[model samples]
Target: MARVLIIGASKGIGLETVQRALAAGHTVRAFARTPVRLVGADTSRLEVVKGNALKTEDVEAALDRVDVVIQTLGIGLGDMLGPVQLFSKSTRVLLPAMEAKRVRRLIAVTGFGAGDSKSSISFLQYIPFRLVFGRAYDDKDIQEKLIKASSLDWTIARPGILTNGHRLGTYRVLTEPQDWHNGTISRADVADFLVQQITDRSHVRKTPVLVY
Candidate 1:
């Protein structure tokens, strides 16, 4: 099992990924400001480190002894309307640390409207995309550029609108521009895909729009 470092593990997709990794027997180092709540699990293999990823020292310290880094940093609408620095800022810290530690694998969740895939967002989803997710995704666009420029083996999983459904494992991994479009995918399934990317090279250095 790999020693996985999950940035922003207090809630959302990061929180779910923590449980997914632990259940698969991987040692999880959860980095966040608040503690991760785990029920009836092995704490020996789980380390909940309280720290903000925006702080350089906190992220640098968390990179220790980690095999795969899964970045699930996110922000609410209130923060998004003003400024969204979490994605680019935290990612800036991660790149050099991963390179320095010789850790090459990274799986980051960016969502469908991120990167060039923005062109593929269906008309039905475009209004909400622009009104709600525009700011956050703009930073994600920067985050993607940074990751692509790096030499690390990275897979950017751009899942469609995230829900709290069970992991179906049948989520489609759409790679081509023609295939990219608006859809829905569960946080659990996205976590499943992120865990698989730790050792799988099928989508390495590639961003696929994951959906059901």
Candidate 2:
């Protein structure tokens, strides 16, 4: 089993990924700003590290001996559009740490509207995104570029609007840039896909757009 390091494993998709990884028999090192909430986690094969992803030293310390690094760190609409510094700053810290520690496999989560998928979104969905989430998407685009340029073996999974639905154990994965057209996929499925990357490595160096 791979020794996985999941950044932002406090809740949502990140938390689900941790659960799936453990069930798959992989050792996990979960990093989050708050560690207490992870008290209920399966400690038998999990290591919870408390730290900010925006800090270099914190990320470096957490990356020690990590076999793979999966980042689900994201900003809300408010933070995303508030300051351009929000996205770049956090990514800046994490990328270098992984490089320094020789952690090559990096799987990061972005959304459908972020990169080359912009033209893939429908006009109706595009309108709201351009008007409201324009800035955030812009910053995420930059983040994706940085990851692509890095020497690390990276796969940026761009999911259409995420949902809390059940994990049906089935979903669509696209290697080419395509719009999800307001499509939705359960967060549990996203977690399953992320954990599967650790050992499967089928989608290495490719951005897979996922949807139900």
- Most accurate candidate by TM-score: 1
Which tens-of-lDDT digit does each residue in 1-212 have in candidate 2? 89999988988889888888888899999898976254355779988899988888899999999899999876566765565555667788888888888999999998888888888888777788888878877888988988988998888898888899878888998876533444789988999999889877789888888887
**Candidate 2 clashing pairs, residues 3+ apart or interchain:** none
lDDT of 1 by residue, 133-183 (tens): 888999999999999999998999999988999999999999998999878
Minimum summed lDDT over a 10-residue window in model 1 is located at 35-44
TM-scores for all predictions? 0.96, 0.92
Per-model clash counts, in order, read: 0, 0
lDDT against the true structure, per candidate, is 0.89, 0.84
Q: TM-score of predicted model 1?
A: 0.96
Q: Cα lDDT of model 1 overall?
A: 0.89
The local lDDT score (0 to 100) that residue 12 gets in candidate 1 is 83
* Deviation of model 1 at 108, angstroms: 0.6
